[model samples]
Target: MSFCLETYLQQSDDYEVLINKAGFKDCARLIRFKADEVIYVKPGEVILGVRIIGVPPIPIGIIENEKKLLIPYTKPCHGTSVVELPIDKKEIDNIRKLAI
Candidate 1:
Protein backbone atom coordinates (compact mmCIF):
# COMPACT_ATOMS: atom_id res chain seq x y z
CA MET A 1 0.00 0.00 0.00
CA SER A 2 2.60 2.49 -1.06
CA PHE A 3 1.68 6.14 -1.57
CA CYS A 4 1.26 7.64 -5.03
CA LEU A 5 2.09 11.32 -5.10
CA GLU A 6 0.84 11.80 -8.65
CA THR A 7 -2.52 10.24 -7.98
CA TYR A 8 -2.83 12.15 -4.76
CA LEU A 9 -2.03 15.35 -6.60
CA GLN A 10 -4.57 14.60 -9.25
CA GLN A 11 -7.25 13.63 -6.74
CA SER A 12 -6.43 16.75 -4.82
CA ASP A 13 -7.30 19.16 -7.59
CA ASP A 14 -6.42 22.06 -5.35
CA TYR A 15 -3.34 20.25 -4.08
CA GLU A 16 -4.85 19.97 -0.66
CA VAL A 17 -2.39 19.52 2.12
CA LEU A 18 -4.61 17.10 3.97
CA ILE A 19 -5.97 13.93 2.45
CA ASN A 20 -7.60 11.01 4.26
CA LYS A 21 -8.92 7.69 3.02
CA ALA A 22 -12.41 8.45 4.29
CA GLY A 23 -12.49 11.79 2.46
CA PHE A 24 -10.47 10.76 -0.58
CA LYS A 25 -13.40 11.22 -2.95
CA ASP A 26 -14.14 14.65 -1.61
CA CYS A 27 -11.80 17.48 -2.54
CA ALA A 28 -10.79 19.91 0.16
CA ARG A 29 -8.64 23.05 0.22
CA LEU A 30 -5.35 23.00 2.16
CA ILE A 31 -4.11 25.43 4.76
CA ARG A 32 -0.42 26.33 4.53
CA PHE A 33 1.76 27.84 7.23
CA LYS A 34 5.28 29.18 7.31
CA ALA A 35 6.50 26.24 9.34
CA ASP A 36 4.39 23.68 7.40
CA GLU A 37 1.01 22.94 5.88
CA VAL A 38 -1.88 21.76 8.04
CA ILE A 39 -4.82 19.50 7.34
CA TYR A 40 -7.44 19.11 9.97
CA VAL A 41 -8.31 15.54 10.93
CA LYS A 42 -10.87 14.51 13.45
CA PRO A 43 -10.36 11.81 16.04
CA GLY A 44 -10.16 8.29 14.59
CA GLU A 45 -9.09 9.66 11.21
CA VAL A 46 -6.89 7.53 8.91
CA ILE A 47 -4.10 9.02 6.79
CA LEU A 48 -1.72 7.11 4.52
CA GLY A 49 1.62 8.05 2.93
CA VAL A 50 2.76 8.01 -0.68
CA ARG A 51 3.92 4.66 -2.11
CA ILE A 52 3.32 1.92 -4.66
CA ILE A 53 1.46 -1.18 -3.53
CA GLY A 54 -0.08 -3.58 -6.15
CA VAL A 55 -1.53 -3.76 -9.62
CA PRO A 56 -5.27 -3.51 -9.84
CA PRO A 57 -7.31 -3.92 -13.01
CA ILE A 58 -9.62 -1.25 -14.29
CA PRO A 59 -13.21 -1.92 -15.17
CA ILE A 60 -14.20 -1.72 -18.82
CA GLY A 61 -17.14 0.42 -17.83
CA ILE A 62 -14.76 3.25 -16.96
CA ILE A 63 -13.03 3.07 -20.34
CA GLU A 64 -14.50 4.90 -23.28
CA ASN A 65 -14.89 3.08 -26.57
CA GLU A 66 -12.99 5.74 -28.52
CA LYS A 67 -10.45 6.48 -25.80
CA LYS A 68 -6.94 5.23 -26.35
CA LEU A 69 -6.03 2.65 -23.73
CA LEU A 70 -2.34 3.45 -23.86
CA ILE A 71 -1.21 2.60 -20.38
CA PRO A 72 -2.77 -0.43 -18.82
CA TYR A 73 -5.70 0.68 -16.74
CA THR A 74 -4.13 -1.05 -13.78
CA LYS A 75 -2.26 1.13 -11.32
CA PRO A 76 -0.56 0.78 -7.95
CA CYS A 77 -2.42 1.54 -4.77
CA HIS A 78 -1.79 5.21 -3.93
CA GLY A 79 -1.53 6.40 -0.35
CA THR A 80 -2.53 9.84 0.88
CA SER A 81 -0.45 12.72 2.25
CA VAL A 82 -1.16 14.21 5.63
CA VAL A 83 0.47 16.40 8.23
CA GLU A 84 2.13 15.04 11.39
CA LEU A 85 0.16 16.40 14.31
CA PRO A 86 -1.80 14.81 17.06
CA ILE A 87 -0.57 11.73 15.26
CA ASP A 88 -2.86 8.78 15.60
CA LYS A 89 -1.43 5.30 16.09
CA LYS A 90 -3.78 3.78 13.54
CA GLU A 91 -2.81 6.33 10.89
CA ILE A 92 0.82 5.58 11.48
CA ASP A 93 0.13 1.89 11.06
CA ASN A 94 -1.55 2.47 7.69
CA ILE A 95 1.33 4.65 6.51
CA ARG A 96 3.79 1.97 7.60
CA LYS A 97 1.89 -0.67 5.66
CA LEU A 98 2.14 1.54 2.57
CA ALA A 99 5.82 2.06 3.19
CA ILE A 100 5.31 5.81 3.37
Candidate 2:
Protein backbone atom coordinates (compact mmCIF):
# COMPACT_ATOMS: atom_id res chain seq x y z
CA MET A 1 0.00 0.00 0.00
CA SER A 2 1.09 3.58 -0.55
CA PHE A 3 2.17 5.66 2.46
CA CYS A 4 1.40 9.25 3.30
CA LEU A 5 3.76 11.26 5.45
CA GLU A 6 1.25 14.05 5.93
CA THR A 7 -1.30 11.64 7.31
CA TYR A 8 1.32 10.04 9.53
CA LEU A 9 2.37 13.40 10.97
CA GLN A 10 -1.23 14.29 11.61
CA GLN A 11 -1.48 11.12 13.72
CA SER A 12 0.94 12.48 16.29
CA ASP A 13 -0.16 12.07 19.91
CA ASP A 14 -0.70 15.78 20.34
CA TYR A 15 -2.42 16.01 16.97
CA GLU A 16 -5.40 14.28 15.40
CA VAL A 17 -5.83 12.34 12.17
CA LEU A 18 -8.98 11.64 10.20
CA ILE A 19 -9.52 9.47 7.17
CA ASN A 20 -12.47 8.39 5.09
CA LYS A 21 -12.35 4.87 3.73
CA ALA A 22 -15.15 2.80 2.18
CA GLY A 23 -17.69 5.34 3.39
CA PHE A 24 -16.38 4.95 6.93
CA LYS A 25 -14.61 7.51 9.04
CA ASP A 26 -11.42 6.61 10.89
CA CYS A 27 -9.65 8.87 13.36
CA ALA A 28 -6.49 8.61 15.46
CA ARG A 29 -4.11 10.74 17.48
CA LEU A 30 -0.42 11.21 16.94
CA ILE A 31 2.09 10.30 19.62
CA ARG A 32 5.66 11.49 19.88
CA PHE A 33 8.44 9.98 21.96
CA LYS A 34 12.19 10.17 22.35
CA ALA A 35 14.57 7.60 21.02
CA ASP A 36 15.00 4.46 23.15
CA GLU A 37 11.86 5.37 25.13
CA VAL A 38 9.03 2.85 25.31
CA ILE A 39 5.50 3.80 24.37
CA TYR A 40 2.48 1.53 24.54
CA VAL A 41 0.95 0.97 21.11
CA LYS A 42 -2.42 -0.74 21.04
CA PRO A 43 -3.10 -3.93 19.16
CA GLY A 44 -4.16 -3.58 15.51
CA GLU A 45 -2.50 -0.22 15.43
CA VAL A 46 0.00 0.68 12.73
CA ILE A 47 3.00 2.48 14.16
CA LEU A 48 5.50 4.36 12.01
CA GLY A 49 8.68 6.11 13.03
CA VAL A 50 9.75 8.85 10.64
CA ARG A 51 13.02 10.69 10.74
CA ILE A 52 12.77 14.49 10.65
CA ILE A 53 15.46 15.87 8.42
CA GLY A 54 16.72 19.46 8.37
CA VAL A 55 15.16 22.34 10.32
CA PRO A 56 11.64 23.58 10.09
CA PRO A 57 10.35 25.46 7.00
CA ILE A 58 11.97 22.89 4.70
CA PRO A 59 10.63 19.42 4.02
CA ILE A 60 12.84 16.40 3.39
CA GLY A 61 12.38 12.72 2.72
CA ILE A 62 12.01 10.49 5.77
CA ILE A 63 13.41 7.43 4.01
CA GLU A 64 17.09 7.68 3.37
CA ASN A 65 17.88 6.18 -0.07
CA GLU A 66 14.71 4.10 0.36
CA LYS A 67 16.56 1.62 2.60
CA LYS A 68 17.70 2.96 5.97
CA LEU A 69 15.44 4.60 8.54
CA LEU A 70 16.38 8.02 9.84
CA ILE A 71 16.24 9.15 13.46
CA PRO A 72 16.48 12.71 14.69
CA TYR A 73 17.74 14.23 17.96
CA THR A 74 18.73 10.98 19.69
CA LYS A 75 20.47 12.85 22.47
CA PRO A 76 18.75 13.69 25.77
CA CYS A 77 17.26 17.11 26.53
CA HIS A 78 16.71 17.75 22.86
CA GLY A 79 13.57 19.44 21.65
CA THR A 80 10.30 17.56 21.13
CA SER A 81 11.05 17.36 17.41
CA VAL A 82 12.73 13.98 17.70
CA VAL A 83 12.20 11.35 15.06
CA GLU A 84 14.12 8.08 15.34
CA LEU A 85 14.44 4.73 17.12
CA PRO A 86 17.18 4.19 19.65
CA ILE A 87 17.36 0.42 19.30
CA ASP A 88 19.00 -1.48 16.48
CA LYS A 89 17.42 -4.12 14.24
CA LYS A 90 18.78 -7.04 16.23
CA GLU A 91 17.25 -5.69 19.43
CA ILE A 92 13.97 -4.95 17.70
CA ASP A 93 13.83 -8.43 16.20
CA ASN A 94 14.56 -9.99 19.59
CA ILE A 95 11.79 -7.98 21.17
CA ARG A 96 9.39 -8.96 18.44
CA LYS A 97 10.19 -12.62 18.98
CA LEU A 98 9.65 -12.22 22.70
CA ALA A 99 6.27 -10.64 22.08
CA ILE A 100 5.31 -13.63 19.99
Candidate 3:
Protein backbone atom coordinates (compact mmCIF):
# COMPACT_ATOMS: atom_id res chain seq x y z
CA MET A 1 0.00 0.00 0.00
CA SER A 2 1.12 3.55 -0.70
CA PHE A 3 1.20 5.26 2.63
CA CYS A 4 0.55 8.97 2.75
CA LEU A 5 1.79 10.29 6.06
CA GLU A 6 -0.23 13.46 5.94
CA THR A 7 -3.44 11.68 5.13
CA TYR A 8 -2.76 9.02 7.72
CA LEU A 9 -2.16 11.61 10.37
CA GLN A 10 -5.34 13.44 9.50
CA GLN A 11 -7.65 10.48 9.16
CA SER A 12 -6.30 7.91 11.57
CA ASP A 13 -5.55 7.69 15.23
CA ASP A 14 -2.95 4.93 15.05
CA TYR A 15 0.13 7.09 15.03
CA GLU A 16 2.07 8.67 17.85
CA VAL A 17 3.66 12.09 17.92
CA LEU A 18 6.65 11.94 20.20
CA ILE A 19 7.31 15.61 19.98
CA ASN A 20 5.78 18.44 18.02
CA LYS A 21 6.68 22.02 17.19
CA ALA A 22 10.31 21.43 17.90
CA GLY A 23 13.64 21.90 16.15
CA PHE A 24 15.10 19.30 13.84
CA LYS A 25 18.01 18.52 16.11
CA ASP A 26 15.73 17.93 19.07
CA CYS A 27 13.47 15.61 17.14
CA ALA A 28 16.49 13.72 15.82
CA ARG A 29 17.78 13.23 19.34
CA LEU A 30 14.42 11.93 20.56
CA ILE A 31 14.36 9.41 17.76
CA ARG A 32 17.82 8.18 18.64
CA PHE A 33 17.06 8.08 22.31
CA LYS A 34 13.71 6.31 22.04
CA ALA A 35 14.02 3.90 19.16
CA ASP A 36 15.49 0.46 19.38
CA GLU A 37 17.75 0.99 16.38
CA VAL A 38 18.83 4.03 14.42
CA ILE A 39 19.65 4.49 10.77
CA TYR A 40 20.73 7.42 8.65
CA VAL A 41 19.37 8.74 5.40
CA LYS A 42 20.03 11.79 3.28
CA PRO A 43 18.38 15.08 4.19
CA GLY A 44 15.90 15.11 1.33
CA GLU A 45 15.14 11.41 1.23
CA VAL A 46 11.46 10.67 1.03
CA ILE A 47 9.86 8.39 3.60
CA LEU A 48 6.14 7.69 3.85
CA GLY A 49 5.75 10.18 0.99
CA VAL A 50 7.33 13.08 2.85
CA ARG A 51 10.72 14.64 2.30
CA ILE A 52 12.71 14.41 5.51
CA ILE A 53 14.62 17.56 6.49
CA GLY A 54 17.56 17.57 8.84
CA VAL A 55 21.32 17.79 9.09
CA PRO A 56 23.60 15.35 7.27
CA PRO A 57 22.91 11.69 7.97
CA ILE A 58 19.41 12.29 9.20
CA PRO A 59 18.20 9.75 11.72
CA ILE A 60 15.33 7.31 11.37
CA GLY A 61 14.30 5.31 14.40
CA ILE A 62 13.20 1.69 14.26
CA ILE A 63 11.36 0.17 17.16
CA GLU A 64 11.48 -3.55 16.51
CA ASN A 65 9.09 -4.73 19.15
CA GLU A 66 6.35 -2.39 18.05
CA LYS A 67 6.99 -2.56 14.33
CA LYS A 68 7.17 1.20 14.27
CA LEU A 69 9.35 3.79 12.58
CA LEU A 70 10.24 7.11 14.12
CA ILE A 71 10.92 10.05 11.83
CA PRO A 72 11.41 13.75 12.16
CA TYR A 73 8.94 15.54 9.93
CA THR A 74 9.33 19.21 9.14
CA LYS A 75 6.90 21.61 7.56
CA PRO A 76 7.22 25.22 6.34
CA CYS A 77 5.92 26.89 9.49
CA HIS A 78 5.11 24.01 11.87
CA GLY A 79 8.68 23.31 12.89
CA THR A 80 9.73 19.67 13.25
CA SER A 81 7.97 16.71 14.88
CA VAL A 82 9.01 13.21 15.84
CA VAL A 83 6.29 10.82 14.79
CA GLU A 84 6.03 7.08 15.25
CA LEU A 85 3.80 4.89 13.16
CA PRO A 86 3.39 1.21 12.46
CA ILE A 87 5.17 0.03 9.33
CA ASP A 88 5.19 -3.16 7.36
CA LYS A 89 8.23 -5.17 6.46
CA LYS A 90 8.25 -4.17 2.81
CA GLU A 91 8.24 -0.48 3.60
CA ILE A 92 10.97 -1.02 6.13
CA ASP A 93 13.07 -2.74 3.48
CA ASN A 94 12.51 0.15 1.10
CA ILE A 95 13.65 2.57 3.78
CA ARG A 96 16.76 0.51 4.51
CA LYS A 97 17.75 0.85 0.86
CA LEU A 98 17.93 4.59 1.36
CA ALA A 99 20.13 4.27 4.41
CA ILE A 100 23.41 6.17 4.42
- What TM-score does structure 1 among the candidates reach? 0.19
Per-residue lDDT of candidate 2, residues 1-100 (tens digit): 5443345445544322222221111111111111132233223322233332322322111222222222222123433233332234543443333221
Question: What's the residue-level lDDT of 30 in candidate 1?
Answer: 22
lDDT of 1 by residue, 1-100 (tens): 6544445545655332444432222212221221232223332223334232212211111112222111111132543333223323454434334321
TM-score of each: 0.19, 0.19, 0.93
lDDT of each: 0.28, 0.28, 0.89
Local accuracy of candidate 3 as per-residue lDDT tens digits, 1-100: 6778888899998888999999988998899899888989999888998788888889999887789999888887999999999998888888989998
- Name the 10 consecutive residues with the lowest summed lDDT in model 3: 1-10
Instruction: Flag regions of model 1 displaced more than 4 Å.
Output: 1-83
Cα RMSD for candidate 2? 15.6
What order do candidates take by lDDT, descending? 3, 1, 2
lDDT of 2: 0.28
In model 3, what is the error at residue 40, expressed in angstroms?
0.3
Q: Superpose all Cα atoms of candidate 3 onto the true structure and report the RMSD in Å to 1 decimal.
A: 1.2
RMSD of each: 17.2, 15.6, 1.2
Q: Model 3, stretches more than 4 Å misplaced? A: none
TM-score order of candidates, top first: 3, 1, 2
